[model samples]
Target: MEILQIDDTLSLKRTVDGGTEEQRKAVKAIISEVRAAGDQALRAFTEKFDAVKLDDFRVTEEEILEAYHAVSSAVVEIITEAAANIRTYHEKQLRPSWMTTAENGTMLGQKVTPLDSVGVYVPGGTAAYPSSVLMNVIPAITAGVERIVMVSPPGQDGKLPPGVLVAADIAGVKEIYKVGGAQAIAALAYGTETIKPVDKITGPGNIFVALAKREVFGDVAIDMIAGPSEIGILADDTARANEIAADLLSQAEHDPRACAVLVTTSRTLAENVLDEVYKQLPHLPRKDIATEAIENFGAIYVADDLEEAVGAINQLAPEHLEIVTENPVGLLGKIKHAGAIFLGRYSSEPVGDYFAGPNHVLPTNGTARFSSPLSVEDFQKKSSIILYSEQAMNENGAKIAEFARLEGLEAHARAVEARLK
Candidate 1:
């Protein structure tokens, strides 16, 4: 990793929007074909991308039972515990409909309703994501969404990963599909002969999958256009260099473009972390991927003071921020932007990713400046409720009619004046 002085400004947006023209064209064509041909297009694209032909895209009851038995009992137990934690955290986010009445007999309130159905996309093959299933589906379950659909590609051997199947079952997701990529996104947006359309889709995938979600957005809701994973650490001399290096590498191994950054006031600590990163890089199983990521996107910034370090973090608006300093709790109030925050050295980034009950699906590419993390709010809708009694209307109708007439609309004034008499 390269070290830089904080005097120089950094450009945080890494890649071009929607990828290259070729990728955009390819994704556009896939979405169109899937929209036109439906099931036939799904099967053709599944065979083309996944290299396996399938007679049926839906997972059967027997296959799910086999998946449960195939996975070790220990794995099942761990997933169950994680699911319970997620459920407990989301249940606190549940909202109820409320109304308030005034002396004027006017009632106003909001009605919170859950979506009818939702689709979750999970990357298949070597990217086994049982934790993602738990994070995406549990919030919808807590929001009271009726149907939860999951889609993933089968392995070359033509079987979904047993752990993924078992996790889906644990999360209460009943409908699992054997298709993936942009085509799968299209099927979920516009219902095919076999698969019913969903109200929303949530989860992460490759560039094609992200672009497909973008294209089908107005037709159905999506979580976010998630970019590569990133982590930003703000540490002082009191922080451990080895622990910082280990946490940074956790996100770098996810992709060659993933970013890992550290900003500190101590130059000596920066040097130590740089040395520790190089020492530990070779030991990782995904060392090649992490190496490319670190070489391209990783950095260490040495700031003159802790205030300057906090300013830099605010400018970057990282997806995940870790504060490891002498007074982490004091610094927490200064942080203005970040999808998630982990304070102190004991609270590592992975604690929230896997076990801490917070949703790991977060805003990326500086989107934390405005957007938010995946939650039960994403799976529900709110409708405004309003009621006006005759006495209330009589009091406000003439004023409304005068305002409408001032706007040069006779019909608008008449609508309010009709009830006046």
Candidate 2:
């Protein structure tokens, strides 16, 4: 890993966001073709990109039952436990419709409604992570969304992974489609003969999938456009070098462009962690990907003090932050921006990624400064409620009409005046 002194302008912006002009154009074309051609477009694109020709797109009930049998009972138990933890955590975030009425008889409230339908994209390309299926679908289920549709690319064998299908069943996802890429996103947004349009879409994907989400966002709500995975460790001499190295490698192994950084007050510690990273790299199965991420996007910066490290972290706004210092909780107050923060040595990033109950679908590319992690709220919508008694309207309508007239809205003013009389 490269080492640098913490400067005012740290190079956290070294990586680019997903999709280029050419890629964007291609994604738009796929979306357009899918919108126009419907199921036929999905079939053609599935064969072209996934290298599998399918007579149908929906995963059968028999396939789901077979998927359960395919995986070990041990795996099912693990997923079940994780799902319970996830459900418990998100249940705390549930909100109810609320209203307030004043003595003057003005009633104001918000009605929180779950979306009617949703589409969740699960990537089955180079890797298949059942954790994502759980993270994306559970919140919608908890929100009481009526219909949940899931789409994933089929392998060359024209089959979905058993773990993925099993996890979907655990999450209560009923409609599973064997289509993927930009075309799948289009099918979800605009509706094909086989796939119905959804109110929203959520999940992580590659550049093509990310671009497709961007293009269809206005037509249908979507989760944030995720970038490459990243982890930032803010530590001191109290933290273990080897443990820090292991945590960094977890994210680095995700993609060639993934970033892993260490910010510390001890130069000795920085050097030790750097050496430890090299030591641990060779042992990982995804060593080649980790090495590329470490060589290109990874770095270790020595800060003058913890304050400087905290400031740099806020600037970077990392998707995952691990605070391993003498007092992780104390440092928490200073962190202004981050998608999810893992405290202490034991609370590693993967804990939150899999079993920790919090949503792992996080905003990336420094968007955490303004955005938040996926939560039960993402699956629900809120509408403001207003009702006034005749007495209340008699007192307020003239004022409302005057305000509307100041904005040069004559129709709005007249409507309020009519109500007043």
Off by over 4 Å in 2: none
Task: Write one digit per residue (lDDT tens) for candidate 2, span 52-168.
Answer: 999999999999999999999999999999998999999999999999999998999999999999999999877988999999999999999999999999999899999999999
User: Would you give me the overall lDDT of model 1?
Assistant: 0.92
Which clashing pairs does model 2 show? none
In model 1, residue pairs whose N, Cα or C atoms come closer than 3 Å (at least 3 residues apart or on different chains), thus clashing, are none
The per-residue C-alpha lDDT of model 2 at residue 375 equals 94
TM-score of 2: 0.98
lDDT by residue (tens digit), candidate 1, 1-421: 7899876566453763577789989999999998899999999999999999998999988888999999889999999999999899989989899999989989999999999999999997547999999999999999999999999988886778988999999999999999999999999999898889999999999989999999899999999999989999999999999999999999999988898999999999999999999999999999999999999989999999999999999988999999999999999999999999999989999999988898999998998999999999999999999999888999999999999999999999999999996
lDDT of 1 at 48: 95
Model 1, clash count?
A: 0
Q: Count the backbone clashes (under 3 Å) in each candidate.
A: 0, 0
Candidate 1 — which residues are off by over 4 angstroms?
Answer: none
